[model samples]
Target: MTVRPASVDDLPAIADIYAHYVATSVATFELDVPDRDEWQRRHAAIAAARLPFVVTERDGAVAGYAYCAPWKARPAYRATVEDSVYVAPSAVGTGCGAELLPALLDMSRAVGVRQVIAVIADSGDEASVRLHRRFGFRDAGRLERVGYKHDRWIDTVLMQWSA
Candidate 1:
């Protein structure tokens, strides 16, 4: 497996992974799965802002992806970043996340980002929570019932790792 910077060519696979999460899980608060054009636009915007967007390839296919973007719009959040990671269901537990996450952290450090935040879907998301914790992320707070999906309310847990 290899972790590398992502490109427009990787957007389709990335969108697939994200769409899966949007349709089946509360990992993201977004209710609607975005179309390819919107996904491309979002990716392009991130790149245009010079943020780090990375992908992990295994056996010549995109197994997962990870990226870091500004935590918030204000100048006070400039030194901090928010991270997102998505792995194809087939790639789970195959070390795709393990490979991509460190690259994201390294990218953050390389760009002088001081803190990395991960907004987990809920406390029930053990994999994501554990992965972030293993990478030195700690629970920052939990915003109760901040998301609605699948006919239920889902809480969001905020985790943070200092660089």
Candidate 2:
């Protein structure tokens, strides 16, 4: 498998992968599947800001993807970043997020980012929680019932990694 910077061509696959989570899981609180045009806008925003947006491919198929975005709008938060990672269901347990995350972290560090944050949607998301933990992220905070999805209230897990 290989991980590399993502381009517009990869957006459709990315949208498909994320749409599943949106439609079937609470991994993300999004209730609507964003179209490729929305993905294009997002990709453009990430690129305009020079953030790291990458994808991992296995057997010539996109197995997963990850990216780091500015933690907040304030200049004071410029040194900190928030990370998002998702592995295609077919590639689950293949260590896709595990492998993809570190690559993003490395790129973030190289760009002088001093910290990374992960806002996991559900505290019960063991795979994502475990993946971030394995990458040295620690529980920084938690918000109870901060999100309502799948016809139930859900909590948010906040994990952080500092340089």
Candidate 3:
């Protein structure tokens, strides 16, 4: 697999990957699948801030993606960022995230980011939680019942990796 910075051409695949998570799981809190325009806007917003958005390519297709954005709107949190990652259904256990995350972290660090946060939608999503942990993120906190999705009340598992 080759890991590289995301480009405009990668938005469609990224949207499809995220749509799958939105429709089928509590891993993300998005209730509806965003169209390509929305995905484009999201990518632009991240790029406008000069942040990194990376996509993993395997056999000429996007397998997964990861990006970090400001943890909060407040300037006080500028040194920190919140990470988002989504893998294609077919690439879930194929180590796509393992490749994407480190690239994201490396890029973030190079750009002066000092903290990376993972706001996992479901506390029980061990795959995501473990992925962050594997990248040096530690359990920070959990907000009980912070979201209601798919007819279920879910907790937000917060994990952090600090440089």
Candidate 4:
């Protein structure tokens, strides 16, 4: 597998990966899957902000993706960002996330990001939490039952990494 920056052409695969999580799991709280156009806009926005948006390819197909976006809109949060990492169902155990996340964080650091926050849904899957922890992220806090989706209340685990 190879990890590299994502391009416009990779959005469809990225969207598909995210859509699966949205439709079948509480990993993301998104109720509706964003279309290709929305993904395009997001790519443009992340590019314009000079942030890192990456993808992992296995056998010439996008196997996973990772990116960092401003944690908040306020100017005070400029130095901090939130990270999102998703791996394709088929590639989940293939070390795709393991490759993509480190690349994302290293690029974020190169671009002057001082802190990275991971707001992960507590979906009873500890893989994400363990992955973040392996990359030096620490438990910051948890917001109990902050999200309601799929007819159930869910909590969010906030993890933090500082450079």
Worst 10 residues of 4 by lDDT: 92-101
Name model 2 segments beyond 4 Å from true: none
For residues 1-163, could you state the per-residue lDDT of candidate 2 as single tens digits?
8999999999989999999999999988889999988999999998887889999998998999998889999999999989999989999998899789999999889888899999998746588998999989999999899889888999899999987
Identify the superior model by TM-score, candidate 1 or candidate 3: 3
TM-score of model 3 vs. true structure = 0.97
Which predicted model would earn the best lDDT?
A: 4
What CA root-mean-square deviation does each model show from the true structure? 1.0, 1.0, 0.9, 0.5
- Give the clash count for each candidate: 0, 0, 0, 0
- Each candidate: what lDDT? 0.90, 0.91, 0.92, 0.96
Output the TM-score of candidate 1.
0.96
- After superposing all C-alphas onto the true structure, candidate 4 shows an RMSD in angstroms of 0.5
TM-score of each predicted structure versus truth? 0.96, 0.96, 0.97, 0.99
Point to the candidate with the largest TM-score. 4
Instruction: List, residue by residue over 57-149, the lDDT tens digit for candidate 1.
Output: 989999899988788999988889899999999999999888888889988888888999999888375999999988889999999998899
Greater-lDDT candidate between 2 and 3: 3
Better of 3 and 4 by TM-score: 4
- Residue pairs in steric clash, candidate 1? none
Candidate 3 residue 134 Cα shift, in angstroms, is 0.9
Q: Model 4: how far is 35 from its true place, Å?
A: 0.7
